[model samples]
Target: MSTSTAGRPYALIAEFETPASTLHAAELIRDAGYKRWDVHTPFPIHGLDGAMGLRNSKVGWFTFLGGTTGFSLGMLMIWWMGKVDYAIPVGGKPLFSPIFAFPVSYELTILLGAFGTLFGMFFLNRLPRHYHPLLKHPRFRNVTHDRIYVVIECADPKFSDAETRKLLEHAGGRHIEIVED
Candidate 1:
């Protein structure tokens, strides 16, 4: 085992058969005063978000901000370039012809919203962290199949390996393992 996991003291790996069981395990673990834990599943389970105690994602807000910024900038650019800089008099339209700028603004809004959501999610989650001790565990490959796994890192202040194992066993997790970091 790598020394990176040595400092954690201990860690518990629990395998659950169903999404419902995984959700229940998470709730029980949280009630048991363990906070540093995560759930892995093949696909997103309905209502699992609430069970895991995750807050609403702020990516929507980021997308909205990006789209608004894009719309404003697009309008400004079109107005300055078409009306002020070039001064094109097409169909006797007004200098600040918003109708002509609608398409550009719309396109910019979509582009910004898509990119902003992608980058915002990555930023908020602090992702691209390819190396994790959990990835070293043998059973982790089952995550893509029929299994759901919950891992409680020992780095959490309120963890005792034996007690945590018992807690997981009681929570209906099967094939529980002690993972070394």
Candidate 2:
């Protein structure tokens, strides 16, 4: 979301020495009221979401809706097949029964719930991406090992090169550098 490809920077990235420093920087960024920023670390750090001001994910709603739809459809399909389509009564049992429908409904609930989680994540995170500007940075490759970083994207409305650099410096970030598109 950089403004242009004509030498505009995609983001500003800064390195932190430890998880504590990264977490502190994230809190500072959040307190500064800047959006469109993120933290990267070698491993998941405790309380990072709170530091970044993130709430619980909405993917659970998608799972609930999908499970409900699947359960309802499963019941309807069994009812239609048993009562209207064939209408065959076996051993004097009821033609449509909740007991019989439950197995299929449970299976469908599991299947659709899984699918909803997958697709919801793809939608929410903007998946199917083939590239990112961060991947072009030579030092960024160290993220998988021992490095922790905070990256503030250029697209943020509050982004200012000088102010953001100063903020990062104040938050204990080191090796701060602009990421060019």
Candidate 2 global TM-score: 0.92
Residue 144 C-alpha lDDT in model 1: 88
Candidate 2 lDDT over residue span 1-181, tens digit each: 6334746788899999788888888999999999999998888899999999999999998898888888998999999999999999899999999898999999998888888888988888898766778878899999998898899988899999999999999999888999887
| Residue 21 in candidate 1, Cα distance off native in Å | 1.4
Worst 10 residues of 2 by lDDT: 1-10
The parts of candidate 1 lying over 4 Å away from their true place are 1-10
| Model 1 / residue 78 / CA error / Å | 0.5
* Predicted structure 2: lDDT: 0.90
lDDT of 1 at 163: 86
Q: Mind giving the per-residue lDDT tens digits that candidate 1 earns over 1-181?
A: 2357353545788899987788888888777777788888899898877787888989998899889988998999999998889987878778887898999999999999898899899999788778667777888888888789888887777778788889999999988887776
